[model samples]
Target: MRQRGREGLREQRPVATMEAAEGRLSSEDSGEMGGGMAAAAVEGIMERIQSDDEECRVQAAKEIRRLTKTSPKHRRQLEGTVVPLVSMLRSSNPEFTEAAMLALLNLAVKDERNKIKIVDAGAVEPLIGFLRSTNSNLQEHATAALLTLTASSINKPIVSAAGAIPLLVKILRDGNLQAKVDAVMALYNLSTLPEDINTILAAKPIPPLVNLLKICKKSSKIAEKCTALVELLLGHDEGRMALTSEEGGVLSVVEVLEEGSPLSREHAIGALLTMCESDHCRYREVILNEGVMPGLLELTVQGTPKSQSKARSLLQLLRKSSYSGSELQAETLENILTNIVAQIDGDDCVGKAKKMLADMVQVSMEQSLRHLQKRAFATPTKQSRTKRQ
Candidate 1:
């Protein structure tokens, strides 16, 4: 399979050699490609994955991926290849680890059998370890792989057991921008678990995340990630309780929303809307006390499409909260409603506030009906019943 020419070493294969082998390999009657030239080529490629030269290793890993993708039989036979590639995860060379990761990504693509195979090979732990690496690209790709694997509902428990939250939070604060983006996505997914979300709250991830939201408001990509994290946080009861903790709770996020990055403003708006759905009375007061309407109006008039949508959404949420419009500053409410009309004319934002207005109006009418229903259902005997109780 290898020719030792004057140049040192070269791949020399006779024409039709692989074709003949391909036919044999495809035939169920024939055994796997054992003790043959195909096996030798596979070995050569695997060996090159460990080459001292970085480029050679990367090239070899790419070839291995291509080879494995070509035939089901080839992939099954090369299942053992995961061992060497996974070992590269610990290599001092980031390039080697990256190439190995790319190869592993392809390896996991063959089928469910391969996916479980790689998972069983103990790849996740080491991959999570790379979250600590200072190399931005490695962190990004490794986190992406983990995100894919951990996407399954069964994997939620596994991810929590792996201590992914603290590591992810660390990346959020210290890693480069790409790393922060990846970390945010992982956290968003992991937040599906109540226990895992508690882990994030324990790490005090919200404050730094709020800080990041402020800094990254202009970046649409980062802003979207920030919004996702907020959505996840507010989705769970534990997460909401944590956010509304006395140290500031929901109020802290409101502070960030008002003072944060424009992108963060959008994300903050969405988070607040979700939280408002089930907020305690005090939490509802926090939103009104923060004076959200005027700031939201400003954002609607001057913010980006996402920001304008977020601001408008927050206005609708505030309107829906337990804080009755009568309790709110009437002038501020008017400004916000006007800004919504102005936004419709300006068209700076891509997302719309039309649905929000309808939702708020519906919620308002529903609340009013509930109040009237309660009063109408009351009987004169209720006063006597209450006194007895």
Candidate 2:
């Protein structure tokens, strides 16, 4: 009986050796063991992220979120994680898909480099897809993430090129109000670049931007951003024309100047001033008779040195316009000149006023000389014709 048991043990040992040889066991080698362990860990994460099991997906997402905050290397891990996570955005279960998307949005905030990587890895399509979701929360987070990504100077042009602007603009008009606000804010930042701006403004984007300003007058954040965008739009000639167009162009601006918030007032004034500079001769009567004079005058007294300077500049613009010097009451001219002289009185802002005043004087002198030349060149009447008669 002892001999039979020994034979059985020897046969079992051979079977174990065959199994080890077939599996290619290498645990005895330290380098191979370490590499195998690392590979297995990565495979495990990939499987969990891809798993249909809700628990597996949630745990993987949570772990990735944690890793994103760990270190730069882990942030780079986001580059890999985003690909699978983006796919998960299409999941049938709203909870699982939303969990995946939030994780992706979290990864996007890690850094600019990570943002570029995510963008390069095709994050735009997924994000735009999420915009169609019925979930307002998803829209908010996705829009916020898109805003951050678009905020990067390097990524801005890329974002524009990826065809996100039109979609973003849609969100501004139709999405949840918060999403609309966020989208407009992003559009403002994105519009600073010529490539992005010219495309949207060429499509007549100013009217909508103007409407937004009217709607958000009481919201400081919205007002500030809206003012900045108005300023930028005012930088272009087409934009000025759009604002002061027959559709209450300059008319809309006048209302803002009258009733808008201080920030809105400042920007509205600045935009009007810029437009006045464009065609002051043509728009002079329109400005003065419309009650812009008092606003311009008050600005000089109550504004910052910068705003005071801007007010003075606006007056200078008005002065350049064809005022009926022959018809303008002397008192009006005197009042304007007096306000200008007062501004030049301030040590801080005087330099700017002095420069402007000198330029005006030079222009006046040139006009006067031309007038004198024309008078001197007048032809003599024919006195001989009367003698012949």
lDDT of each: 0.58, 0.58
Clashes of each: 4, 4
Q: Tens digit of lDDT per residue, candidate 2, span 203-271? A: 566666555554443224555555667677878887777765533345445545544556666776787
The TM-scores, one per candidate, come to: 0.55, 0.61
lDDT for position 176 in model 1: 69
Candidate 1: where are CA atoms >4 Å away?
1-59, 62-80, 92-95, 105-115, 134-141, 152-154, 235-270, 289-291, 294-389
Worst 10 residues of 1 by lDDT: 1-10
Clashes of 1: 4
lDDT tens per residue, model 1, 119-209: 6777788888888777777886676566545545555577779888898888887876655655666677677777777788777676556
The superposed Cα distance between candidate 1 and the true structure at residue 313, in angstroms, equals: 10
How far residue 324's Cα lies from its native spot in candidate 2, in Å, is 6.2
